[model samples]
Target: MKAAILDQAGKPLVIGEVDIAAPGPHEVLIRTAACGLCHSDLHFIDGAYPHAMPAIPGHEAAGVVISVGSEVRTVLPGDHVVTCLSAFCGHCEFCVTGRMALCLGGDTRRQKFGGARLTRGADKEVVNQMLNLSAFAEKMLVHEHACVSIDKDMPMDRAALLGCAVTTGAGAIFNACKLVPGETVAIIGCGGVGLAAINAARIAGAGQVIAVDPVPEKRELAKVLGATHVVDAMADDAAKQIIAISSGGVHHAIEAVGRQASADLAVAVLRRGGTATILGMMPLDCKVGLGAMDLLGGKKLQGAIMGMNHFPVDLPRLVDFYLRGLLDLDTLIAERITLDQINEGFDKMRAGTSARSVIIFDT
Candidate 1:
């Protein structure tokens, strides 16, 4: 199989052929259909997040099941599925507590003592898989729990975004924030995930949705997706603008750009007793918080893992939303490229001019 391999941090991914192992008792084999380029992958490539080298980096993906292991009954050949990095162990304390997203998913992978799932076809050297799914390749072998069946009619390119950007954005609203109708929300950043957050806020019936970003194009795009107002993050009084627009702070604030400043703005524009959810993958050394006065006013700040999603249940519903024309997956996809053009796709992402670049496998 052809895959874009990341041999080291702060370097371009190299395209190469890799050998894949057949599924184990609890695994599934999927023929990759489409995978979306995401900022999370960029973090690893730019060396912001640390990971093992010689790995394939990608996770947001949708594909067709080619085969399943003996114990895998959730999906069968011909089933269309979307893969999530948040693979879970059903019996873990997190899973048993209704927080499946927090599962460490240790049981999902082949033991390090055992042979690896992927290897360099030439040298037979073991290649690490990123986030368990490694959707950058022509095919993926993952634990059954990492994927969920969706409607066949869903476009592979669009379904791919649901695996990460959409799920994380929408899940932040439905799962973490539990936003009620008529509430106000301010979202910082209007990229793929930020736009999805804007769209979901509208569907959740937020009375006022404020979209904040430095780019005018993204702000314009946000309005099209359902933002009631847009603020320029680079403005001298951006936080003040959010508070003024929402009539003295919003009910909830979401940070999607993964920056300390954006997270700070999310906290700055909150109303009394409101909550701020940080969805961006901030630098490991970065620390963000509020002062004593801010907390004393009942304001809260917290982190969310993969939008605190319950993938098995949420993914299907998200597919339904797209089918019903409620979710704007079509606008989220900025371009489509083949596996060989993977590096170019990442360049576009770094430029911040595109929403999402999807890799379409020629199946």
Candidate 2:
């Protein structure tokens, strides 16, 4: 299998052939179809996030099930699926209580001494699978819990986004914040995730959907998605503008940029008693919190891992939204490239010029 191998942090991903193992007892084997190059991947490649070296780095993906292990009953050969990194152990305390996304999923992966799922070169050195899915390769061997069968009618490229960007963004509004129809929302960042939030906000019937980003083109794109208002993230009075547009602070402020300033902005623009959900994977050492005034106002700040998603229930619904013409995935995707162009795709992402770039594998 060909994969984008990250040899180390702060380095370019090396594209080369790697070996993928067959599925384990609770695993599924998938033929990689399409995978999105997300900012999260960039964070790992740029060393902002730590991960095992010589790993395949991709989480947002959609593919066809090729085979399944003896115990895997959720999917079978020929089933189309979207993969999520938040693999859950069904009996875990979190999963049992309906918090599957928060499940540590510790048991989902093979034990350390049980051999690796991937290897490279003649030496056959272990190649870590990033976030369990490792969909950047020609194939993925992952726990069955990591993926859910989606409608066959859903296009693979668009389905890929549901794995992470869309799931996280839409889930933030639909699940995490429990956004009311008439509530106001300000999404801080116009990237794929932010745009998805804007679209979901519209579907949720938000009274005011404010899109904040420094990029003019993205701000325009945000409007196309469903933002009722746009604000320059770099503007000195960006928060003021958002508050003014909503007639007060927004009921929900989401930080998708994963920056200290953006997180602070999300906190600052919240209406009294509003909630701020941080979805970005910020630096490991970074801290995000609310001030005394924010606490006094009943403003809440928290993290929503994978938008607190339940993939078994959420991924298929998202696919339905896209198939029904309600979710505008066509506008969400910026371009498609081949696996060999993976490095160049990341370069574009680093430049912050494109929306979501997907790697289309030759099946």
Candidate 3:
């Protein structure tokens, strides 16, 4: 199978043939159909995040099951599924407590003593899997827990976004924020995730949905999707604009840009007792907090990893929303390219001009 390999940090990914092993117990093999290039992947590729070398770095994906291990029962060979990085161990305390996304998923990967799931060339060099599911490859071998079968009617390209960008964004609005109907929301970023959050805010019946971004086009698109108002993130009074748009301050402020400025703005635009959910993966050393006055006002700040998702339940529901026309995924996709064009797709991502670039695999 051919995969885009991250041979080294701060370098272009090499497209080459790689060998994928069969499913192990509790594992599932999938014929990759589509995978969305997420900014999070760029964190590793640019060395902002550290990982083992020669790894395949994609997590947002959807595909059809090729086969499953003897113990696997969640999906069958013909089932369509979306893969998630938040693989959960059923017996973990986090899972039992309904916090599956925080499970660490240590049990999902094979032990170091075990053989690698992927290898390259005649020399058979081990290729590390970036996340539990390395969907950049032609095929994927992942823990069954890392994937959930979804409606077949959902287009693979759109479904791929549900795996990460949508899941994280929508999840932040639905799960982390627990946004009540008629509440106000301000999404700090208009990328795929932020747009999804904007859409979700509308679906949840938020009284005012504000989208913020430096890009004019993205802000316009956000309004088309669901945002009742859009704020220029680069403006000197962006927070003031958001606060004024919401009539005082937003009940919920979501930070999806993964930048210190955005994080600060999220807190700045929140209502007295509103919560700020930071979904973006920021720099390791970056710190976000509320000022003493803001803290005294009861403003809360928290991080929602992968939107605190329970993929098995959330992905299917998200698919239903799309199928029912309640979710607008078509607008989220900016381009569809073949595997060979992966590099160009990343280039576009770096430019921060597009919504999302999806890789459509020919199976």
Candidate 4:
């Protein structure tokens, strides 16, 4: 099987052969159909996020189940599914509390670490799966918990983004922030994840959906996707613009850029008693600093992992929205590349031009 392996930081991926993995107990082996190139992946490649090198890094994906372990019953071979990072353990305290996204109990549903899920060079080295999916390869040995079956009719390429961008964006509103109708919302960074936040704000009945991005291309695209306003982060006083647009501050400000600056802006533009959801994956050891005095006014800052997604419930709803023509999955895909062209896709993402470049394996 062919895969793109990041063996070192600040390096191009090595496109080469790797041994295909078989399913372990409670796991599933999926034949890769499509995987979206996301900015988060680049963050790891650039060492913004620490990852064991020589790893197959991909998380957002959709594929057909090729094999399943004996204990796997949620899906079977030939079933189409979308993979998510929020693979849950039903017995975890967080899962029992109805916050499955926060499930910390290790996946009883699958094997852990280097269980021969991926290997390279005549099996001399084992490769790690990013977020346990590693859909960058020709196949994946993932916990069955990471995947949820969706309509096979959904273009696999488009369905792949639903695993991360769509779920992160919409679920933040419907799950994490629980945004109310007519609330003013500002989304920082109009990339794949941020754009989803804008579209979700619209679907949630937000009164004002402000799309903030440094790129004009993305700002324009955001309008088409459902943002009511677009603000340039590079512009002077961009935070002030958001505050002005929402008449002092937005009720919900989402930071999807994963930068301290954007995190501060998301906090700064929040109205009193407002919530700011950090939907992006920040670099390890970095913190979003906020003034204690400002926080005293009841403004809140919080982390949202995988949009606090409950895959079984949220994924099907998102798929239905896609089928209903409300969610703009197509609009989010700026380019469709072959699996071999994944490195170039990440380059485009780093350039801040493409929204999302999906690897169309089945195409």
Candidate 5:
């Protein structure tokens, strides 16, 4: 199978062929159909977040089940699926408490060395699977819990992003932030994730959705998706513009760019009692600073993991929303490329030339 491998940090991904193992007792082998190149992948690629060395970086993907383990009954050999990396162990303390996203109970994968999922690559390497799904290649051996069944009719190209971008964006608003209707929101960064947040906020009935970014193209795109206002962060008094348009402040602010500055913007734009949700994964060493005096207004800041989503439940609903024409998945995909062209896709994404470039393995 053709897979993109990253053996070092701050380097371009090496696209090549890799052999994969079959499924285990609770795993499923999926024929990769489409995968989204996300900023999280960039984080791992740049070593902003340390991990096992040789790794196949992909977490947002949708595909068809080619085979299943003996114990897998939720999906069949030909079922269509969208996979997530927030695989839960079902019986964890967090799972029992409804915080299953924090479960880290998997069989402690065997490598201490970075990057080694394949043993035949000469040195018994330990190419780490970014997240658990590792859907970058033509095939992946994912735990059953990491994948969810979606309607076969869903466009695999766009459906691939639901596993991450859309889910994260919508999940932040509906689940983590628990936004109220007619509330105000400002989402910083107009990338795919940020765009998804803008769309979801609109669906949630936000009265004033403010999209902020340095790029005018993205701000325009954000408006079409549901943002009532757009702010060019490079322009003078950007945050003040947000405050002015929103009339004092917004009820909820979200940071979609994985940067300290935008997170601060989300915090600064809040109205009394407003909340802020940071959806982007900042570096492990980075921190957001807030004054003790800011809490007096009952304002809050929180983090959202995978949109605070449960694949088994939220994925199907997301698919339904797309199928019903309520969610705009088409606009999210900037272009489609074949599996062999993945490097180009990543390059385009890095240049910020597209909202999202998908690796379309099946079509």
Candidate 6:
């Protein structure tokens, strides 16, 4: 199978043939259909996040099951599925407690002492899989727990976003924030995730949905996605504008951009007893917090992983939402490119112009 291999940090991924092993026990092999290029993958590409070299980096994806291991029962060959990075071990404490997304997923992969799942076809050198899925390749071998069967009617390109951006954004609102009808929301970014949050907030009956971004086009797109209002983050008083629009402060503020300033703004525009959910993956050394007065005012700040998702359940429902026309996925896709155009897709993301660029595999 051909895959984009990252040999070094801050370098382009090399497209070459890779050897993918057959499914192990509890694993599933998928014929990759579509994979979304996400900012999280860019973090590893730019060396912001440390990862093993010669790894295939991509997680947000949807595909058709080619085969499954002897023990796999969640899906069968010919089933359509969306892959998630938050693979969970069913017996773990987190899974038992209904926090499957937090499961360490140690049992989902072969033990370090075991043989590699992927290797270079040329030299037989092992190639690390990114986020347990590595959907950038022509095929992916992942734990059955990492994928959820979805409707076959759903487009693979759109379903790919549900794996990450949609789940993370809508999950933040539905799970982390537990947003109720008539509550006000302020989203600190208008990328794929932020726009999804905006759409979810509207569907949840939020009284007001404020979208914030420096990009005019994104702000406009956010409005189309259901944001009742849009604020320019580059303005002199972006936070103040949010507070003013909400008549004091928003009930929930979501930080979708992994930046210190955006996270801080999410905290800044929260109402008393309001919650600020930081959905972005900030730097390890970065610290975002509220001042003493804000805490005294009962403002709460929290971080969400994969939108606190339970992919097995949430992903299927999200697919339904799209199928019902409740979720606007049509506008979310900015471009559809081949595997060879993967780097250009990331370039569009870095430029902050495209909502999402999906790689459509010819299977």
lDDT of 6 at 324: 92
Please report how far candidate 6 places residue 76 from its true position, in Å: 0.6
Error of 1 at 20 (Å): 0.3
After superposition, candidate 3 runs with Cα above 4 Å error: none
Q: What is the C-alpha RMSD of each candidate to the true structure, in Å?
A: 0.9, 1.0, 0.8, 1.7, 2.4, 0.9
Clashing residue pairs in all predictions, respectively, total 0, 0, 0, 0, 13, 0
Q: What residue pairs clash in candidate 4, if any at all?
A: none
TM-score of each: 0.99, 0.98, 0.99, 0.96, 0.94, 0.99
Q: Can you tell me which runs of candidate 1 are displaced by over 4 Å?
A: none
lDDT of the structure predicted as candidate 3: 0.93
Question: Which candidate do you rate higher for TM-score, 2 or 4?
Answer: 2
Model 1 lowest lDDT segment of ten = 108-117
| lDDT value, candidate 5, whole model | 0.83
What Cα-based lDDT does every candidate model obtain?
A: 0.93, 0.92, 0.93, 0.86, 0.83, 0.93
Checking candidate 2 for backbone clashes, the offending pairs are none
Candidate 2 shows a clash count of 0
Supply the TM-score for candidate 6: 0.99
Predicted candidate 6 versus true structure: per-residue lDDT over 1-363, tens digit per residue: 999999998998889999998888899999999999999999999999999998999999999999999999899999999999999999989999999889999999876665789999667899999999998999999999999899999999999999999999999999999999999999999999999999999999999999999999999999999999999999989988999999999999999999999998999899999999999989979999889999899999998999999899999899899999999988989989999999888888889976999999997
Model 1 steric clash total: 0
Q: What residue pairs clash in candidate 6, if any at all? A: none
Cα error, candidate 3, residue 149 (Å): 0.6
